[model samples]
Target: MAVARRRHREPHFVDVALRHRFLRHAHRDVQRRRIPLPIRHPGGPQVKLLYDWLTKEQGKDVVVTREPGGAPIAERIRHILLDPQNKGMDPKTEALLYAAGRAQHVSDTVRPALERDAVVICDRYIDSSLAYQGLARGLGEDDVLHLNEWATDELLPDLVILLHLEAERGLERLEGDPDRMESEDVSFHRKVGEAYVHLAREYPSRFAVVDASGTKEQVHTQVRAAVLPFLAPDRVET
Candidate 1:
């Protein structure tokens, strides 16, 4: 079981790799699980707080990881995808690259962690591609989804915690310069926001949307509420 520490007043974001696979059933016979924390609007990586909180609260072996770069090979691919110099990269190529990286990430990182009964907290997953390259880049969502589904062998998130904020507001909140994905125009980001809403509606069973316009503490509170039920007594690792 994990140990608990005193709560801090001010929380800092840790840009670490995170992917979630929570155990929901008390019966040890049940299979392990995975959850994705996909921030609709890219800004500060806020999910780390939840990862940290859950680590102390859940008392389970936790694995923190991210997509497009969890494994060594995937990290190299992430560099190519995020390099500003890679501007004008074809939309299809970009989507394929993301899927390629995800394929490696799942095989080498996510799957192995899940198999070990650890809770994997992934920072992003397939929904990112469905929104970015699929909707924002003018590629069809179904096509992109299909590609990733094939790439990842249809492993889906048991729960999707989406942090919602206006595209413009999110961009304004960004500190320092933008990465390749963040450098996209406002219009592109708006489309990404819309894409997320569409996905939430499309997969209502697994999606939980939390407004992120509030302070980090407020946002973290909401995220905790959304995740608490999943950590029911039956789900806690013994």
Candidate 2:
């Protein structure tokens, strides 16, 4: 498994490319298995990358945009979460927003992609909520899990790639400007990292941790190595 660390300040284009490669490969592998290819939602620090990649690399035709007041329900929830007024919202309400967004994302974006045989590489998924809201927001695991179940009807990813990075290194990679959650203190980021580690340990079969301390290419190499197995029948040669 690959584990890469990341900070809110770093540019996300590299990470976006890595995620796209991983999803494209995984989609092909699943097709080989004669099963429906699963979609990927790049969550956490790489969310914005989803928009850029879809528009530039994947083409607007293949990607459905989720703008505010757009057809996608997830976009609305995203708007709510990113709003500064959300800071004082209760944990349950926050969890509900995430769930609402996930539901819309899956039904609107993911389901259509599956129908068209297109690989859906999402910017973020339910895991972000589990980590940010469930763990960081101090909601108990049970509550978080329950909300997740309610939101996605218990649908989980076939594979979850957790980019593992040291808090200090991740922060350093950040370009100084951070979003609401990204701007959180180092201590909170540490907790988020710890939560991801715990998840990897808890679900080894589904989780892959990629080391993210190296240069972008180096980290991409590690990520590609981790994803190679899911890409083909033979284990990744690397």
Candidate 3:
């Protein structure tokens, strides 16, 4: 007799959202001292108290191991790219750090969430590295793709949500907190945009482009529409 195969059913939107909320809480609890994670919606007073307890009730001495979150990875990559010492570092080394950080992040954060049936919303992933580092080091597209595949160990996102903002608009959004990478020359951002467009063209099924030039509500609407199929049965088109 043939062995029976178990089919894995996809999680509903609300379930995924709740799981994401828990993961966000865990992530924020880990980094309470550094930067506070933004809450997507206002919760009851109990939730607030819970958040505070997670931060304070747990003794500061109780070390939560540092996981490779997307924000930290981006910050680290920006530092490495801008470091004068890195000017002498070969392209392979540069690529290695990115791959290492990504692997650690996926292993620590993303993989766990996926296992628990949560939808992972990342700030940036392989595509960003492919565009930024690949262009910066003059690595060809093939090499970039190969490096990303090796680095991520071929773990791919179910959907890649690209916030398509005009270069000027994206720069404007970064005006308040001008990090080294955020403050890069407009020309570079333009190239990044171009690369993103190329990537989308090359992988249309995986990529969903959202007009991020609009207000938060507008952008959210667009993103919601794009995500509706996976989110709700009613939203799915026959």
Return the top candidate by lDDT.
1
> Whose TM-score is greatest here?
1
lDDT ranking, best first:
1, 2, 3
Stretches off by above 4 angstroms in model 1 are 1-34, 43-45, 234-238
Candidate 1 displacement at residue 11 in angstroms: 40
lDDT of 1 by residue, 132-228 (tens): 8888788998899889878876666656778888889989988787889888889888899998889788877667789988888898888777666
| Candidate 2 lDDT over residue span 1-238, tens digit each | 1112111213211121122212222221221111111112222333234334434543422343331212356666677776765567777787777777776766666556545544344444556676777887788666887776665545444455576778778777766456556667889988888877876686575566777665556655554555444432332234
The local distance difference test score of model 3 is: 0.49
The TM-score that candidate 3 achieves is: 0.63
What lDDT is obtained when candidate 2 is compared to the true structure? 0.51
Q: In candidate 3, which residue ranges exceed 4 Å CA deviation?
A: 1-68, 71-92, 175-177, 232-238
Models ranked on TM-score: 1, 2, 3
User: In model 3, what lDDT does residue 117 have?
Assistant: 44
lDDT to native, each model: 0.71, 0.51, 0.49
